[model samples]
Target: MNKIKNIGIGLLAVVALSMGSCSKDFLDEELTTKYSTEYFETAEGLEALTVSLYGNIRWHFGYEWAYGITLYGTDEFTNANDLTNEMWNTYDSRLGPIGATTSTGAANGNATSPNALWNEMYYGIASCNTIIANADKIDDEDVRNRCLAHAYFLRGYNYYRLTAQYGGVVLQTEPASGVVRNFTRSTEEECWAQVISDLRNAYDYFEGEVYTYGKGITWTKATAAHFLAKALLFRASERCDDWNSSYKQSDLEEAIDACSYAITARGGKLTDNYSDLYANWTGVDCDIEQLDEILMAAGHNADSSTSGRFGNRTYNYFTPQFSNFSGSWVKRGVWIGGMDFQRCRPTEYSYEVYDHVNDARMWKTFKTVYGVNNVADATAGIEAGDPGIVMILNTKDDHTYDSYTFGASKQAPNWTDDAGRLPEWTVGSRQTETSGSLTAETGQWVPNSLVLYQNGEYVASSFTSQPICNFFAGINKTDDGSRTAEKGDAHRDVTMARLAETFLVRAECYVRLGNYSSAMADINVVRARAEWKSGENRSYYSDGSQAFENNSLNTGSSAEKYIYSNLNMNTYYLSNPDLEVTTEASSLELTSFPSVLPDEDEAIMTAIGASSDYERALNFILDERSRELLGEWQRWETLSRTGTLITRAKAFNAEAAPNITAGKHELRPIPQTFIDGLLNDDGSNLTEAQKEAWQNPGY
Candidate 1:
């Protein structure tokens, strides 16, 4: 028998009593302790342990790039022409070609890199597991519970990210307890169950207001509920194959319930001015009052250490110069231009969705250089009458200038002679006239046409010069000179889980259940918000017909042509009233017209109110989701979950196969190293089933 010490080390250190080995009745002997699960006992110790869990939230370069690529790199949008490397390649929808080099999956040979995103997610899960296991031992209940809730939230979030990418993953709730830790992958249902349980637990512990870092604002129970609701909604959608097999209406009901809870609990309402939400990168001037819509955000600051510099760089890569910090370069002699990489360009499909005039979001999101800059200024010095010259002063004098053809008439303005003539000389003319040339001892002389002049003297001119104009018209710029701007900071925090989404979701549910009128009412709520005017306040069409009334334009051959054309005709018509139905315009035309497509409007309304309304509602929700959540990191998963990757592939004209075949590509491939290194030599003792199951479709 070993005697226990009276000194308090909590329950961590205890003596084990042996039955047969003891020689004396009350033998007292201290045996060296090998392993104990009771290491975290004190409040301070537990707090430190909990704080360590946050280290799991890392911002890896590859992970960030992948997330952005999977969403913005596809055909739905195009990269700005100037963006290059992985971004440009990906945006071209050459995934097989480029993903081979850039993607973290099996397409590349780097399926073994430790920094592969799969490893990061698992590592994050492990940290959460540690917090979950140790938090309960803390002396302070509040601290323990709070820490535990955060752990659960983080764990759920990580799992959500993982499951979204890899389908079902093994649910590990604790740290490795033995020399070997191996488990098979759980079913999608099982994984979602765990996620729901974790989120529910988190809700219980962190439902009340909790302060967030930087913003110092409290995330209420409503926020947690909103997150949970979004998760449930995604599950209900069952876009992922694993979940698709077992999707149920009950899941949608649960999602709706969660969203409703968030709305009611938080006194929920959409922020009145969506633009104000993202007006600044730092949260300094953000209206906390509008935070009800924003469930959570990865915070950023201008301070060096905390800023998301990479995110900012990525944003600058995609957005135009005028809408970003590069715009400030107008004051600097250096004029900024876009990458022209086509990686960040919005697709013709995406641009059409916006009701440009009424939607404030459109202007804030995109900048037509033609609209913002003086086209005359963009092609400034090259045009006739411009006093400036677009001469490239290079280090070495090895540049040449050629005469402009009739079609290419724009050229840099000729430099003035010593006499200070405005137009020094005309094209092809080298003679120095009295009025336009310098009068010197050696007769009239023109300033050296080949040399670049700064103040008045000739500087070296050696660099090549082309027309100083942007190929594409619109460009984005930073709000200020802040290079640390994030795309999230540029737009209104118009959340995806808004009241409109909920209504759409409910309408979808009702449609699925064949409840058309109920779904119609729900959808109408959203349309009403847009001010279409109903009943007594209803507006009529130009033909004195009610806007919603049926007509040949609404139900005939024109409707089919309109649907088939799908040329963003709405936006085109809005921007150009003179746009002939047959002829496409050379440039974007901004107009104020009243042209609305009856088919699309009727289809959307019918879908929202159809007997098969749920199906129609689903399509409508997805379409709207694409429109509303352009840069919100929703598209990839939405397409993946709904099995719409094929549709997207066709739309984007990607090199990928146009069918959603069941294979490794659907779920991302598990890194090969994880399989080789993390398993036993014989592979008999490892979680082989889980490992195999988690591999993506195309891998």
Candidate 2:
């Protein structure tokens, strides 16, 4: 971060660089000329600045910081066992006002610090201020209005995030041209009011018209309305209890109305298939930048040349170390999914919230199978296409296999029943080992299996290795197999706002308004999309099939390919007997509030002490949000706004539960650099007590 006399000055220094026209990359812009006030007053300079704001949007969604700030320390995710970025997830004494100074320091530096986000967002605000102040220089009315609209939306978007993370930060709407240190905090209410006002201005300028540039990555009327609804929802939430009583009802109504414009009025219908929204393969049909459901995204190009320094690294997190297993059957980089960064592992609560039996999302969103990739494993009758290890996410005893014969010869006698069995080895108990002939045979069944984990517990295995961070379930949504290199640029655009979240936002409003039936109706709309339709192949998955097809480039590789190329892949189970009761759409819908939370979910709600009906309803919405939007960067704000951060963290997040405090942990401490660089508004530096007073309570 650039040190300055004040925080605003540090933010303004980057405004000149952002006034350049965009290059081939949507996020790459270089300053071509020296800074000048007169140059920015020109039409070309102003338009160029407006274009740069699109690139600036990438900072919020592109890198590891995206997950660190939102997903970490929340119930949806915890640090992997092997992960070093523990400050954010653990919320220990290290998560202080100074912020993380390096990747492996006390914390994870900018990735997990409020410091970097604070500076970058204010820099963006400074840029937006420059554009909004000078966009009038453009003579064409249409261009001028467009520039203003973009500026307003970007400003509101940045402030919305800042306010959500650190309540009532120094609100600056004007561009700071020089160093100064007279800064003070505004009330949380004032910050939200300014954000709402800016968004409304952008909405009005759009005039219900939708314009998309850089594919579907740019802002539109729908995007403005969606965020407006979200901001209103935040203000209407319990976090605003001290000052929200007078306007809570109106804010909820307005939020619902804004959602109506974004969802129904403006062509904001969801994609027919949930897989379509996150088509991660490199097929021609995998284009997702212009999908109808995505209101806005952070765009990245397929061509790596223009993908900027860090091109959408959101794909690199949330993965387990599948390549580091005990057996020789699995290898790294041969498959299309990302490298095993293992920074954002899902919590036990994250997996339990899903309606695993009826919802297709559990099967669609998580990868539960790893195919044999090593050539040497072929001798065990486990060819490259064979299912190496299958994880059945069930707790029922009937779903398990009775016995297994491990390290046995090829001529092993009857490794359990051979008739009417599934495609591969099943998930079951190890009751007995069968006697077999000592000699091996060609093209005969043999065992060289790795351990298998079922429902976060190690149920059975051929290898004696213990299951830890290396065997947890992986989220399939950020799976990017299309990259040419192990750490290459990801082509998929980072989804920001989509129709699914819009529906959930409305459902939450109804819940707060005491309209349980209406809330369920809205909630069911998203759940219905998550349901597995009748007669659909249960074993197919889109990403897996594409990965297998890609693997076929190696000659004679026997990867399993899905028969239906058009439809995405499903769970590989042929006849999952336990899930038969609720495998279709109707079975997935909730009839009313408290419609039976899963066992783990019910336990968390209990720990949170939701004694009242409204309290339980809010907790239910939080669970639903995790099920639908786990790794999408929404958890922290959702928890914070509902004032459930402390309770939920205590209930579900093991790492953060013991260390997080109620009042202090709700909002991040204001960055220490910002606090240290301030003056007392009278040409004198702030005293130690003054600095302490300026920071958030407890930190």
**C-alpha RMSD by candidate, in order:** 18.5, 6.9
Off by more than 4 A, model 2:
1-13, 16-37, 101-111, 280-286, 303-306, 376-379, 396-468, 544-586, 594-604
Model 1, total clashes: 50
Estimate, for each residue in 217-333, the C-alpha lDDT of model 2 and write its tens digit.
568888889999999999998888989898789999999998988897546557767777664445322556567688877655565433555466777787766555534445656
Clash number by candidate, in order: 50, 12
- In model 1, the Cα lDDT at residue 326 comes to 18
The residue-by-residue lDDT of candidate 1 on 146-264, one tens digit each, is 77877787788778777776666667787655445555567666777777777877788884665443232233455556667666666765464344445566766776677677656
Model 1 vs. true fold: TM: 0.61
Once all C-alphas are superposed, what RMSD does model 1 give against the true structure? Answer: 18.5
Candidate 2 minimal-lDDT segment of 10 residues: 431-440
Q: Lowest summed-lDDT stretch of 10 residues in model 1?
A: 536-545
